[model samples]
Target: MTQVEARDSRGTEGSPDPESGTRRARVRRAVGALSRPGPWKRGRLLATPAALLGLLMLLHAHITDRGGLGSLVESMLPWFGVFVPVLLAGALWRRSASAVVALLLPVVVWLSLFGGLLVDKSHAGGDLTLVSHNVGAGNTDPAATARDLTASGADLLALEEITSQARGVYEQELAKTFPHHTVLGTVGLWSKLPLSDTRAVDIQQDVGPLGDAKSDDQKLPYNRALRTTVATDEGPLAVYVAHLGSVRVMPRNGFWTDSRDRNATALAKALATERNERVVLLGDLNGTMDDRAFAGITAQLHSVQDEAGNGFGFSWPAKFPVARIDQILVRGVEPESSWVLPATGSDHLPVAAGISW
Candidate 1:
């Protein structure tokens, strides 16, 4: 064997016959390769899990409701950005340029979906002031609710879930600030300005699910919505105060009653035909503006809080809000500021917004 062959085979001098120097060299090279450490494979493993966590956060937004299975997770959607930035930081720590670059896609996706909200203001437009609330039907202190709502100093007030029994009490309590008022069954509208042509809007319900099925009440009608013309100083404005059907989560039945669905459709139709250019809609929709159930309303009017609200701005269970079922929506009017007021005797907190022409 040649000297080079012997060296390559044994990786040493004079180890044995037929050990060529070339073979010894090859052996030495193999030993050196085995002893050296490799690049960070563990880092690659972690990137996948971190990426998945980000995707799950986005999915949670679609199915989450205050009463739904992912309610808690949904409430936390605002904070997901904090985690996303951290995930990218992990990739940076691992010195994985590919994973780091990969994160930009998710970052872009999240930013596109929610980035607008991160801005300080919702939009730039002429301003109009309005307020909305769901005074509990079972509330015992109608006068107190009125007092609290009046103190909000809103230009227009829209109320919902008012019972027949408490109608007079509310009227008396709010008469000083809102002299112009109208009530259509359980729902009502009150305005600081003069109200004219006030009428009940039939929201496609013959009768809600709670009533007699065989009776005409069971048939869908459009009376669930109410509209009135307010003579503002600038010009006459059309206002709609509607209380869409309430949603429920039952153990045996999933989202049992859909009276609200029919009501929403009817409301949407009515809004579509509204001739007035400047329109304002306020009410307790029994669901969030983001919910697909309220698409009928969302498509027509823009929410004030979603545009300028600082936090989640939950208004239900006034004691501790986790979802904003009540809302103030406006079209052709600009909202300057929006916020939720302190709890009254009702189950929902009063929300108010300031606006200008």
Candidate 2:
């Protein structure tokens, strides 16, 4: 029990605990990390993906004519772009000054693409004014739709989904405004001026089971498109009124746009080969101009509403329009004014466009 033996025994019993020291060091390190800024790191992680998606959308619009997938992407991309700026702002909310600047990528993209669309209308000149409407297959009141269309005072009108049952009502109503008109299959046209050389443009191919139903009384739906020349104030303008293919959304099926895509291809091919330089295509199209299914039509003709309409201009359901399924498209004609008219007891609101050649 001497002093040296006592010290040695105490040292062995309570040597500086290596485990406790390591634990204390870890705690200090964690506290230091907590004191440091972290929001910026988190913000960068979120902002990068959003900024990239925004850029990809713009690039898609340029490199390829939007197909079905691209159109779906386009319609949704604007809302997505909105988040890019907001997320960037959030990244800066609790972080360093440099975080605010990170939003420039999305800011530039949004401004370059959508800013022009927001600007005040500048007059684009065209020679003739045209109107296009689907007129709705289940439209209960054809006369009302026709009268409303006549009131619009369009030089040329294209109608689609003109049911045989309602055809007479449309003709009777439209005859007062347009003396010259033509009806082929389920579509028809009325012109305040004159129309000529009417022909069915054969909008269908041997693709669907419905296509093979040749029986005169077969209760199957057949695909068809029509074309005619309207003698406008400008000149003879080739007017095509087409109901390409309807798209449906089902709970089980994602999106049914295949028929539409094929029909769009056919319509696009026909339009590309048209002899007339000044062409106008008007119809239901079963899709928005923003939709890729209408790329063939959009590529050939410019939407009057997208060019000149004031707002979202939704035209479906007549009562409330969520998406603009009805459209007025023109090639070689400048859209002067565009608007969706009031509903006329139909599922779709009548869309009108004033154009000059």
Give lDDT tens digits, candidate 1, residues 169-230: 98999998887888887678788788998988878654533433344346542345689999
lDDT of 1 at 204: 67
Q: Provide the lowest-lDDT 10-residue window in model 1.
A: 208-217
Give the residue spans of candidate 2 off by over 4 A: 1-34, 42-45, 59-69, 82-89, 92-102, 122-127, 205-223, 250-253, 290-295, 306-312, 317-320
Candidate 1 displacement at residue 334 in angstroms: 1.8
> lDDT, candidate 2, residue 223?
42
Colliding pairs, model 2: 71-292, 126-356, 126-357, 127-356, 127-357, 128-355, 128-356, 128-357
Q: If candidate 2 were superposed on the true structure by all CA atoms, what would the RMSD be?
A: 7.5
What lDDT score belongs to each candidate, Candidate 1 first?
A: 0.73, 0.71
Off by over 4 Å in 1: 1-53, 56-110, 122-128, 205-223
* Index of the highest-TM-score prediction: 2
